[model samples]
Target: MVLFDRILLAVYSLFFTVVFILFSAVMLGWPVPLFLLKDIFYPGRPEIFWPLMVILILVGGRLFWSSLHKPRGRHVVLTESALGEIKVSLHAIEDLVEKVAAQINGVREVTSQLFAVPQGVGIRIKASVTPDVNVPAVSVEVQNLVKERVFEVTGLSVSNIRVTIESISAKKPRVE
Candidate 1:
């Protein structure tokens, strides 16, 4: 699936680039190669305008079709049964983990990054906890929250959850 996706993206990119170069040539009134303009239809002599419009329309149509057929998001899995390996976007998984961690009690802030490994997601979570919060307990809570949220949202199991307590806020200094 990953290979197929890359191939499709490459094809799409190539098509767009060719279209862009051709359009630029047309706009600048530069003569286009006869072979490149063979398939294009023009009422009279092949004017740059008509061919340009045709290329634009074709590119637009391809984009629309690809968008319709494309996966909803990077992290989405297309099939349940895996004949081969599946790749999920680390960014999407990280965003979900951060969201989950933010919901935990005493969590002031949460930031996370994900690393891709075979078979599962590896996550690193950095959290700011309340001054009075227990660091170890908070770490555990964050780990569990991240795991559940990522699994629920992305359908990907987390293999590792490394939690770091960055800083704890101290109580406001008493007024003199």
Candidate 2:
């Protein structure tokens, strides 16, 4: 998350924490410092209080909804010729990456994720390879293969490709 988002979340969390403590104190009949917010709830000032409530509700509601509804990743605009436009989803790119990675010789299992970058898209791949495979060489191969195939198919430049070798699996040899 960005710095602004972190700060906003911290403020929201602090506000809720204080509110919870105050309410719990009141319910438990414990000594409470209600004076801290006494001016905020001035009974004589409906004009000020109502507007504050409205503003708080609107802003809080918006923030609540935003937290629940995360933003979707951006799509790649492949073509914008005189005739029309073509957009490709990040999921499709991820699928392509997985397929390409699977085609590599020593890869045992593979999954891919994509992120939008300024020039085009960035790819992150996680895979399990055969136990005997060379780690550095295979990693480079995976990266190159994914980048080449994605660009060949989608015509979108891959900003970068990262390959993480999650595990090395050994398959038992069959005895005849």
Candidate 3:
């Protein structure tokens, strides 16, 4: 979404919420809110009134459009399934990479993103490793392990695995 659109949405939501609250209060016999918002409820200037009304209606419609039409995530297709075609979400594959990579001795934390390549997936991993371990060795181990495990579980080849040592964490691993 564009910055301007986001700002408009935020403004719309905030004012809408406040208006609803004021309306509810008026309904419950408190007329103070109604008097406070009287000018907005019954605008005096047609030139300002028409443009503001149009903008509000357009923003409301845009909000509805956004709620109904959300972007879908990419998935890998597995054509070799015995029963039927299978689709695996790239997000799930990314989670798999994170889990596999974080199991390595030196890795303190892991985050990953996956891309669907031809007949396979490519992974980019961001890892926080222990301050005491060899970074190069740990990165290599994470890459190999993630590749192997993804293949073992999904039966899809991993085209590439790029591991970045994002941080050398001084703290010990968290227990789960």
Q: Candidate 1: where is the Cα deviation over 4 Å?
A: 1-88, 170-176
Alpha-carbon deviation at 82 in model 3, angstroms: 8.1
> Residue 161 lDDT in model 1?
90
Tell me how many residue pairs clash in candidate 1: 0
Report model 2's TM-score to 2 decimal places.
Answer: 0.66
- Runs of candidate 2 with Cα error greater than 4 angstroms are 1-10, 37-40, 44-54, 64-73, 102-120, 126-132, 166-176
Give the per-residue lDDT digits (tens) of candidate 1, residues 1-176: 35655666678688678767887887778766434655553456567657767766776676666667856555545345657646666666677788788788788667998876686668888878887778999899888877887777667688899998888966442467
> Model 2, range 104-153, lDDT digits (tens) per residue?
88886789898767876788899988878898899999888888888899
TM-scores vs. true structure, each candidate: 0.48, 0.66, 0.65
lDDT of 3 by residue, 37-130 (tens): 6766667767767787998999999978876776687777866577887888888888888888878887877899887677566889998988
Worst 10 residues of 2 by lDDT: 31-40
Query: For candidate 3, which ten residues in a row score worst on lDDT?
Result: 39-48
Q: Give the CA lDDT, 0 to 100, for residue 21 in model 2.
A: 86
